[model samples]
Target: MGWRRSGHFASLTEDEEKKERPKVASDWTLAKWIMKYLFKDFRSLAIITLVLVGLGSVLALASPKIMQVIIDDVFNTEFIKSIDERFNLLLIMTLILLSVAIITAVISIFRTVLLYKIGYNTVKKIRTDTFTHLQKLSLKFFDTQESGRLISKVTNDCDKINELMSGGIITSLIDFLTLIGISIMLLVMNWQLALWCFLFSIPPTLLISYFFKRRARKAYRKTRKTIANVTANLSESISGVKVSKSFTREKRNIQEFRTVNQENREANMKAVAVFATTFPLFNFIASAVVGFVYFYGGWTLIFGSTAILKAVTIGEAIAFTQYVSNFFRPILNLTMFYNTFQSTMAATERVYDLNHSTSDVVEKTDAYILPEIKGHVKFEDIVFGYKENELVLSKFNLEVSPGEAIAIVGPTGSGKTTIVNLLGRFYEILEGNILIDDHNIQDVTLNSLHSQMGIVLQDPYLFSGTIAENIVYNQKDVPFDDIQVAADSVNAHEFIERMSKGYDTEVGERGSKLSLGQRQLISFARALLPNPKILILDEATSSVDPYTELLIKKALDKLLSGRTSFIIAHRLSTVRNADRIIVIKDGAIIEEGTNEDLLAKKGEYYRLYQLQFKDQENGSNGH
Candidate 1:
């Protein structure tokens, strides 16, 4: 059987796509939202962090005061004293400074630890919540989103939030507080000199910061977008490597990847350039402040005549210079902090958008569990579409008796697979009802409904695990004997036992280590092990060789004996044994009956059967 490739629903224009993208809040708004949520549960940890920071800031501010005391009281004193007395005083001051430094270091260590705990734990919860939300979303969400973009949000975006919480938030707070404390101390010591420092330093610092903040935010935003593009490209390239090789498009793929990489590189360079220019400007302003202080204060001390300032001793001048350095230090650090804060805010906005997305398929509040369904299914006047004003299935109706087998055949885009999708509740119907055992599927819990249904798609997916684990997946505590029995029923046991590790053999990612036929058989065994009341085989044997196809047909006969099974097949021979054959066209059922009955009608199903099976029939006749 071959699949007819139908073009996807038309791609939306850029503007329309943007409109459909998740809405992101303003940076400040998102930051505040995250802060409130984080602190709601980590209030005590936050309080402890603040206390440690406050103590550390106080200790840091005391350094200049101690320096001033040493210079003014000991070095500049005129009182006569023994050398030993002088040494003892100096030693005592040095020991006090050492003690303060040690205590502050200890506090800083504890503060960092606490901040990390709060940051990591909060991010862990956020990541968990985001993943859980994604799980509840309908399959339609995945169809519209890129896997790489979604993966980036879960991993890269959360990491950025962690950076903000663990370091950016706490360090910025401490630096701001230290800036304020230093300003107050500087003014108390020498108001005139402090005035000189502020006049020269604050204006330039503010100007430089204002200029960089806007540029940095724009640059980092571009960087984030470029990185996401690169990630998306890489993911698609890896997943479609086989197709690329078959089409000899390796060079083209490389060129495409290189283009994305170049975009990312250019964006990073722009951000780096902004930082480069901003840092030097900050240093120049700081140096200019120091120069003004020395020139003005020295004139006052030496000449002892100035209208704007009082005369100062050498110790006071030295202390003032240290305070000047301390002031600009935080300013420079704050600039870097602002950059990190912007990046985090951007990431937060993305994460928040994903977590808040609404799922189209939602379980009703009063939905009840499906109690041991007996495989009777009904579709009444169904109307559905993947996009607005473009229905894939319209006014569709069907009824299946318990333990009956039905086969569905249609041209691609005739809404064949859509039936199974609707039955499985992967997408919600626009207008109509689907019932299992007379209970509306929408009114039943998804878990309870899904637990009783088994589906095997055209391309079987096997996660990274052992063969045995993949066979008994989700059916907990299934013994080896039961696994072997299921495999044997599907002709998978013979090959599995022939392998060195038997059932314990590892299947690499997506079962890359196994052939397509082997993977299908394993999937068949997996679905059968659960003994579901309803089984769906959508083109399940289409890709296998003739020998494997025969094996699958034999297995299907046994597996479908007592189940309400839906088989969607392109191969006419495969559906010949079905109790009923359904032919759909243009989202509507045109003909349906037993295989022989449909053939005798010489209608849509008859034409399709002839087109697919006529060549084989002719070959058989020649033989």
Candidate 2:
């Protein structure tokens, strides 16, 4: 079993395989989409945050200028004649600066809280929209997708977008405005100092930014891809752990994990290398600019009365140095913000594509609801294939009267399951039509069609919940008595009652707590609970033991009473009583009739019965 299962869990692709769908051309579109969610959904919070940012910037700019006043005006003996008046002026300026600092701190606190609310609210909407859109997509979209990658999209990628919404873009915008405000203040006080500082500092800042932008973008994108890959590998490994242990493949599994983990480490190291170099370089440039300001300002102040150098006050000199520091602060902040922006852009690209990806199967805008049906079905010259240029079923046709029971038998890959799938309209037929009760399936709403049908696959899936919950899934407001009745009908009530908690016993993930037969019984109970007009059991009894299957066989008549049914099974004994036995080969029906009639004909159906059913009869007679 382990060797057989190995191929299913083979190494997965690191990226989602590309398809023919259109790609997003630019990161700007994703940015705008995120902003739209932030502002449109929670406009009040967004507006309030912006206003606080603007007010905080104003106070930030004012506090530094007030320092200049305190130095030049409050303490100047020439400006104020009396000592008491100068002291009084000093007290007032001190109080005003204190008030500005206090107000700025208060605003900062409120702005931080608002940003959190905005970030969470925006992300909630994005996650919800992504999930809702995914639900609308056809099964074909999911058939080729890796489950781990999809989980990564919903969890990790959305988290990156949340980071951007909370603190990345909004604060960076405020920082830019603060940078501009500092520049203007410096120029107003002294243009020569401001011009000289810009010449030395601005060029290097721009040069560094230009040099790292592309590298950081590529590095961060690789990191995002690698992380998704790691997540996918982890998910697959956990799912296949049983098989791996069975085959003693622990060492091999560990080695495979190490390979993926190492790739992730390398990608992160590349991004971190860029991050490590950027801020220090910016900090060095800032320190040099600040030093130059102090040096030049000191020379001007010391060389007063000289024709070549302008006189500068001590107060102006101190303020000029502070302003230069403020100017570089935003630049450094921008450098840091850009790194985060690059990662967010990578995440946004995957999320945006997922959100916008169109479903290959779509219902018409004007498609009407399918009224309660009588279960008459028709497949008129159907043609389809799971992949391009391949045909699983071609020029195939079948008509089932209301309440007829059909048993489809064929060799593997002979399109037995595809015939039933077409009846349910799970896949679109390439060149034909499926009609239920004279209503074209494509013309009817999917919900109305699916609501009246019940399907039980070969592998029964039960969610993690109490047995009662699993049995009553998707059918709201069902009475406990009704649940017991459905379970009893399928012979599940006896075992369920034997458990400590009876119907309330937890089934664990995918019903792992129960035996395979028990899970199949629960699935049968679930399917029957709906009392659907059409019932499909595709190898539904394959997992049940002979004893449990015998119990199910006894109740088959009651389960199929007054409902049209299609049964696809490998065991010849299961379909001996169907209203019509259709023997298919190479996607075409080669024999069709009652069991006795087909046996008399000695055709494909007779041959299958002789090969499969004769052995079962002989073993039973011998016993």
Clashes of 1: 0
* Candidate 2 wrong stretches, greater than 4 Å: 1-22, 78-85, 210-233, 252-277, 304-310, 614-623
Q: Which candidate is the best by TM-score?
A: 2
Superposed by TM-score, candidate 2 places the C-alpha of residue 356 at a distance from the truth, in angstroms, of: 1.7
Q: Model 1 over residues 1-623: C-alpha lDDT tens digits? A: 01002212112122332453444775556767677757787888888888999999999987777777778667865847666777777788888889899999999899989989989988998999999999999999999998868998999999999999988988988999999998998888888788878887877787787678667767877897898789889988898999989999999999999999999999999999998998888888877877887888778867885667777666777777777878877887787786686567667888999998889999999999999988999999999999999999889999999999999998888998999999999999999999999999999999998889989999999988999999998898998899999999989899999989999999999999999899988999999998899999999988876777788898888889889999998888899999999998988999999999999999998888777666676764111
Compared with the true structure, what per-residue lDDT tens digits does model 2 show for residues 251-275? 9988988998999999999999987
Error of 2 at 583 (Å): 2.1
RMSD, every candidate, angstroms: 7.7, 7.3
Which residue pairs overlap in candidate 2's backbone?
A: none
Off by over 4 Å in 1: 1-23, 79-95, 214-274, 305-307, 617-623
lDDT, residue 193, model 2 = 76
**TM-score for model 2?**
0.90
